[model samples]
Target: MGRKVALGGILTAISIIFLYLAVYLPSAKLTMYFLTGIIPGFILVEMGARQAWLLYFATSMLSFLVLGNLVNAVPYIFIFGIYPLIKYYIEKTRNILIELTLKLLFFNIASLAVYFIWTRVFLINITIAFPIVWLVLGLQFAFLVYDYVFTRVIFYYWDKIRVYWRKDVR
Candidate 1:
């Protein structure tokens, strides 16, 4: 329990740092935002869903307050931050097709929800800048890339990194 708390604290600190960097570095904002999910991914793999949730929410609230941007934190907190934990359960079915399908479904819905909230509620007219189809296609491709990268990272962490980390922690 102490180890879990310590690890969760580390993950939360890393996530918050990434989010703060996202706010300061406008050009690298997207990359920083995406990277914020990585530590939570590690927590999800090493600990469990409950601890991952704790770390995620801690980062979300800190990002919201420190960064002062609910928009920035929404997608991460609602979807990307917790994806690895969700994927752990999804992959238990032992069917690649089911796993991919569910992952895509979650990605698409979360993407659309963020888009809806931004465009409709906030009235951020993106139509004048980019067509809707183009945006959707971009998000589709982005999710594909994210899914691929996530799988590789998870594999590496579980098979290679976990062994070392577990020894030290134990």
Candidate 2:
């Protein structure tokens, strides 16, 4: 129990640092934000969905406070941080069609929410020229690639380091 708490705390700190880096370093915002997503994946793999969610809530709330701009953290909190658990359940379903369908549905909903926040709340002139359909399709493709990469990363960690780490996780 103590070990889980310590690990969760550590991952939460790392996630917060990533959020801060994204907020402070404009040049590296994309990279830092994407990197932040990986922390939740690690937690999901190491602890479980419940612990991963705890970390997600902690990171998301802390990110909003640190960012001082809800728009900036919406992508992380809604899409990135939660992807791993979604992936876990999708994979467990063992139905490629259902997995693909659910994955696309989730991505579309999240993408629309992000889009709505950016355009409506932040008033970022993004969809002025580009059609909303195009934007959503692009996001869907990107999410597909992201999902593939996430699976590959999980495989790599599972074979290389997860065994050793799990020994101390409980």
Candidate 3:
């Protein structure tokens, strides 16, 4: 219990740091957010869904407070932060078609929510130089790639990093 709490706190702090980076490094905002998103998966794997969800809430609230901008926290809140849990449950079904369908559906819905919030609520005028459909398609493709990379990272951590930690402790 002590270790779980400590691990959760450490991951939460790391996530806040990533969120801070997103605020200062505009060019790497998405990358930083992506990296932050990866932490929840680690939490979920090491602890459990409950701890991971707690981490998500802690990180989300801290990010908004720390960044002082709701817009900056949008990606983490709307998409990346909660995605690992979503992925875990969806993939547990073990049906590729269902998993793919649900994952893509979640991505599309989350993307739309983010877009609507960014443009409508925030009143940020983003003039896309291309058709909106093209942008959506590109984002869909990018999401698939992101999902693949996310899974690979989880597997790598479980297979390699976690093993090393266990061995060192022994």
Candidate 4:
């Protein structure tokens, strides 16, 4: 209990610091920086540990939009959805590193479609670099390294992640 709280506090502080620096860097918006600040702790909390929902809600309140703007739910979906889906797909199958790679490749295609639709529906200005930038951003946000890193990491814990889907356990 104490350790998780301490870790969460430390992570929150670190996130605030990172958010400050990123905000001042004159690239992404301050809200975007806040979103980055929030993600790591969000991941930690959602691991079925600690005050996950509390931390998530607090982070959302801090990062909330006051004036009307299109929500950047993309970041959240990338973290929770794509990352989990990729992991789940990889963990469920054996000797299928190549297959996992193909799935993620196709996942990127779907993500790009979502990006296009989101921009077309909400964002007034869609830059030419949006797709390219989002793709790179997706790779980072998805927490996926190259095919090599994935093969190595997944091989190590294939059984562990796979347990979540097992009827015997869940």
What candidate 3 gets wrong by more than 4 Å, as runs, is 167-170
Q: Which segments of candidate 4 are over 4 A away from where they belong?
A: 26-61, 65-77, 80-95, 98-110, 113-122, 129-170
How would you encode candidate 3's per-residue C-alpha lDDT over 1-170 as one tens digit per residue? 89888989999999999999998899999899899999999999887999999999999999878886779899899899999999999999999999999999999999889989999999999799989999989998999999999999999999888878864544
- Candidate 1: tens digits of C-alpha lDDT, residues 17-87: 88878777889987886788777778877887888788877887787787766677776776777777677
**lDDT tens digits, residues 80-163, model 2?**
888887878888989999999999998888878888888888898873577877876787898888888878878888778888
Q: Report every candidate's CA lDDT.
A: 0.79, 0.84, 0.93, 0.48
Top lDDT hit: 3
Q: Tell me the tens digit of each residue's lDDT in model 4 across 2-97.
A: 755775566555544444444455476544444453444344323442354444444444433321232443333333223433444565666577
Error of 3 at 84 (Å): 0.5
Residue 65 in model 4: lDDT: 39
- A best-first ranking of the candidates according to their lDDT comes to 3, 2, 1, 4
- Residue pairs with backbone atoms closer than 3 Å in model 1 (clashes): none
| Residue 145 C-alpha lDDT in model 3 | 97
- TM-score of each model, in listed order: 0.86, 0.88, 0.95, 0.42
**lDDT (0-100) at residue 38 of candidate 4?**
41
Ranking by TM-score: 3, 2, 1, 4
